[model samples]
Target: MAASRNLPIGFEASVAGGIPILRVIHESTAGDRLRAVHGILNGTANYILTQMESRAIEFDQALQEAQAAGYAEADPSLDIDGFDARDKLCILARMAFGGRLKVSDIPTYGIRQVRAIDIHSAHRLDSTIRLVGSAEQTEAGLEVSVRPWLVGCRSMLAKVEGVNNAVFLLGDKIGMQMFYGRGAGGDATGAAVVSDLIEIARDLAAGQLSAKKVSGFLDSHDVGICPKPRPVSWYLRLTVKDQRGIVARVAEVIAHRDINIDSLEQEPHLPKERLSFVITVEPVSEPIIQRAVGAINAFEFMLEPVLLLRVE
Candidate 1:
């Protein structure tokens, strides 16, 4: 891979103890130069989140349904904990931005903490949630992360539901293009493998079998992921052991951070002992929100950690 990047070689060969090997050239600029790549990489996570939004189910229930449908395994730690998507994002970022990256380099957040109330809140805001793996070339460097984001109802990302996958690639020339299809199941994976095999077979038949060296993978430059703190709306949910001045106390923290609250809502018909408070805040940096959340969670009235979601 290193030799291919430095040499004038259109093809390069590799061997594993006399066994023939093949590699796909993924960085083809046959059309437009890519600016960004974003996708729903994990089908199991997507399916679970889809159920939570479409059926108004809780995370555990959606996960169980996904397992029953074979979309998830009995031990779905990688997908549910965001590692699977993190791995995928690493590869995608390398291909898209041509930089060295590791799974641990990117910030990742999973859907394990997502609740029915979060989904319901999303609906009220005319939006839904999806696990998005994205890599974009920005001034700060390659901005990459794998996490759940609140996508507007009319957005293309929100249109992807259930086990289906959609990859959106933005290019300087082509603008924005999306590739959508089934994301999981053996049949889908097998089809992709078979397609590559058939292409290789055709090349061999035509006496054109040769190693096609791909770029980007060999770049050893460290991808400097500077945190680009852009102001954006946020959704925060706090489960509390209901007590007096809960809202006032939380609001004080927000005020201390210099963040403005857009709205505050409480889920009605819930027991006073355990209640959920939903807050929407005006555009604020993630650091500001984190500080406020940290202070709020330190309160004794808190029953669970706060859930935070970015409003797209």
Candidate 2:
């Protein structure tokens, strides 16, 4: 209650489990002109990667180990799948960008599907996998997406290691600033919550709280979601039951779609019952490849949906 905490401005904690952090300070606006915001907010992926590094285990196995250790949950989809990252991003975006936004409105893609092969590919190019939520000013609106990306080695953003959260801000004078540290764990986020509360109390005492203090998140233009997202290479993993004409059928599908296969590899020693085929495709829009995948999934002999990844 405002009486107990002397809260007239407000106090609302969210999906973050920081034992009620005062993560709200965006209400202050008497001077700030413009701001940029983002968050690296998921804990599961961070924890999984840390486990992978420590145990020298594959990502999937590391995630499983994290789940068993209670560092992850029964259904860690929220964390691993990218929703958790989006929620935290929503809060940060509202505070930093001064915009109104609902968590659901933000597009999200999880790292749950990232296999060791994908991570390996990222590193081969001197990159590292990171879950990033980005917002950039544009002619239409703010462009944003929560997805796994291969951050270039040259990017300081790439320097962020496992379980560490980092945020970048760019503005008139602020130029470029990064808030990097414990993205998770009770200590880091909990400290953030407490700090928020302190600022809220200070602002309320100074009569700086105003309901009209606006944010552009929801109000900002949708920024047209980068439709027809620029052509990018892709990684496709196909599982087959070792039936006849499997490879030929696949090639035909790719050809019909006007997509070029850059390289193809079949892991040696794969059992006849379950063979893994990896396909690297030249740069192309996603829909083109999705059609090909759709047709491939229709085959009864197809093991499951062919896994697809947008290559960096």
Candidate 3:
């Protein structure tokens, strides 16, 4: 309705707080075709992961501290469970790809399963974990998801610690650009609100309301899902009852699926009743790896479900 009436509508604060990421995609990169838009969209979740990494604490302890520090809500399911990021990703995907995207359609995975042992294992491999939301235009379609990725120490995602956000934009003409700042705080959100108002006032003084012509915001076209996503490395952590031939059995399952094991390690000097096994597999599509994971999980020695993570 507002667009039809040539009314100026501002929503700069709706996405990443105070970063002006929407404006960058809407105005600054208008000439270029956006190939991808991805980043850490949730400050609360980022804070929790960084806290666990720095303090060497469990997810529960980190949640308590985040609540005490006023970084999280009493009902933090939206943030910690990855739905908050999912909603934001849908908006960004629509803008970047110029199509209507349903928030529920995108796949989402949270950091709730992350444990202290996972963090310890990540440190040993010189990597850390971050909840990332990504959307990219592919030959098949738009590939999108919100999940925890095992990022190396030197990567930009790992550098964004605490209650901060970072957004990366890829374009054919502009190449790659990054936007980083405080994602959600009273000050940051307020600043964004004021900036939007200032723009509206300027438009009013000009005697013309700005009509938003963004394709994704106005178009009703549906974005197609990528049928087969490109292959990537993966990390699988399994806790199981100690017994003979466990490794052989797990290897057989992976081999049966035609997936190669990149590296496998068992934590030293653990209890005989329970042990931690970390497996790194070579690049393979999600479906094939999942099949192998299902086979391994069905074994009698498996104590719990496998924790699978994407390796960056």
Give each model a TM-score. 0.82, 0.67, 0.86
**Per-residue accuracy of model 1 over 74-132 as CA lDDT, tens digit each:** 99887787776676666556656666776688889888999998899888888999888
Local distance difference test values of all predictions, in order:
0.72, 0.62, 0.79
Q: Per-residue lDDT tens digits of candidate 2, residues 127-211?
A: 5566777665544455566877656667776666666666666665556666665555444644432334334333434657442
> What is the lDDT for 10 in model 3?
60
Error of 2 at 312 (Å): 3.6
**What are the RMSD figures for all models against the true structure?**
7.3, 7.3, 5.9
Count backbone clashes in candidate 1.
0
Check candidate 3 and list the clashing pairs.
none
lDDT of 3 by residue, 59-167 (tens): 9999998888887889989889988778777767776777677778898989988887888889998999999999989888988999899999999999989888788
The positional error of residue 39 in candidate 2, measured at the CA in angstroms, is 5.3
Model 1 CA lDDT for position 222: 78
Rank ordering of all candidates by TM-score, starting from the highest: 3, 1, 2
Error of 2 at 35 (Å): 11
- How would you order the candidates by lDDT, starting with the best? 3, 1, 2
Worst ten in a row by lDDT for model 3: 192-201
What's the residue-level lDDT of 238 in candidate 2? 80
Tell me which of candidates 1 and 2 scores higher on TM-score: 1
**What is the Cα-based TM-score of model 1?**
0.82
Could you tell me which 10 consecutive residues in candidate 2 have the lowest summed lDDT? 21-30
What TM-score does model 2 achieve against the real structure?
0.67
